[model samples]
Target: MPSNVEIKAALRDMRYLTQRAKELSGTDGTVIRQQDTFFKVPAGRLKLRDFQDGTGQLIFYERPDTEGPKLSNYSITPTNDPQGLVKVLTDALGQVGQVKKERRLYMVGQTRVHVDSVEGLGDFMELEVVMEEHQSREEGVTIANQLMLELGVKEEDLIDGAYMDLLLKNQQNAHAP
Candidate 1:
């Protein structure tokens, strides 16, 4: 696996290469989209037996706050688990529910956009533009701008973090009220 810095450099180079390819082909110039399915398990319950995909994306989970939100650390996800990981999670949570599947479309100059359907959380779309390298902040913003234009994503629709964070916030709000 590449270090963070190396990964970032590679991504930057990839973006540049993609742009050149588009220019040559006179294409609109966007990266091909990839899809990931997540089976969310309660924290601390993940294990080798619990995973089927063998691969995972470590997400920097976050929660909402006045200034925006705070990082809630990373969540490791198995890449592909067809053996009903969601069912296992629901059972662990002691809830008779279904798993949520999301299809995310990512482009070079845009926030990550996903069409998601949760068994209990309902159907929703989410957008997240990640900032990786220290030097690529400006470039990331520019890419986000272009993606917004191409994908018709609005500024107001931009989200701070993941669905789990939103769900936790709502639960807290309900308890408070």
Candidate 2:
């Protein structure tokens, strides 16, 4: 599995953060609207990312649900038939949750800085420091930490779970009358 050091946090100001990220980044960022549909799986978390350009990818990933940066191992499969896949997966594996967001992606060295406006969940930031096949997890974590500090991510705003998990929790609470 390919790996990266990842962190997620509550975003206070997307505009300010994006400007800071642009200043710190070497390349211009790309913004895209995304819809992530998660499905129940026997092992690992699975989701398909559907983009506005009709492109999609199925991702299966596993990472420790801990605050701060952690190593995430993942596999991705490109898909052309996302709608069909969603229908089949929903019937077979059951749909778990979904997240819709507008994401601004910026690359700082080998790390990806994400400023996202998530529907229902408000603003958020995520960092993914891509690791080389020969790279140690510690090295990736260090990169993530350095970038986090550079981008003004505070320790208190760190979160352990994915957006889908948070959305699911909110849904459960809403129905727990």
Candidate 3:
């Protein structure tokens, strides 16, 4: 499985973050709109990510839902038939939840910086510092930490889980009261 040191945080302002990222990377970044349909799996989490460009990826990943940078092991398969896969997966595994976001993606070295506006949630940013096959976890963490500092991500804004987890929690809360 391919891995990365991942960190996610709630964003206070997208404009400030985007500017800071641009200053550091000097790239305008790629913008994408995505909708992820999650599935209930026995281990880890599975999602079929459909991009607005008519492409998609079937992603499965496992990681502890921790507040700081943590390791995530994942596998991804590109699929052209997103709608069909979504239906089949939903039918076989049962749907968990769906999350929609517009993302501004930037690359700094082997790291990917994602500035996202997630529907029904809020603004957020994620850092995925991809690791080489022989790379140590410490290397990925070090890179992620440095990028965090460069990007001005505060500790207080760090998040504990994925967007699906947070979205489901909010839904439960809404229905509870």
- Model 2 residue 28 CA deviation in Å: 4.1
Q: After best superposition, candidate 2 residue 42: deviation in angstroms?
A: 1.8
Error of 2 at 131 (Å): 0.3
Better of 1 and 2 by TM-score: 2
Error of 1 at 49 (Å): 13
TM-score of each: 0.41, 0.95, 0.97
Model 1 alpha-carbon drift over 4 Å, by segment: 1-99, 104-113, 118-135
For candidate 3, lDDT tens digit of each residue in 87-150?
9999899999899999999999999999999999999999999999989999999999999988
Task: Give model 3's clash tally.
Answer: 0
Clashing pairs in 2: none
Per-candidate local distance difference test: 0.38, 0.90, 0.93
Prediction 3 TM-score vs. true: 0.97
Candidate 1 worst ten-residue window by lDDT: 1-10
**Tens digits of per-residue lDDT for model 1, 49-69:** 222244333332323332211
Cα lDDT over the full model 2: 0.90
Q: Native-vs-model 1 lDDT?
A: 0.38
The segments of candidate 3 whose C-alpha lies over 4 angstroms from its true place after superposition are none
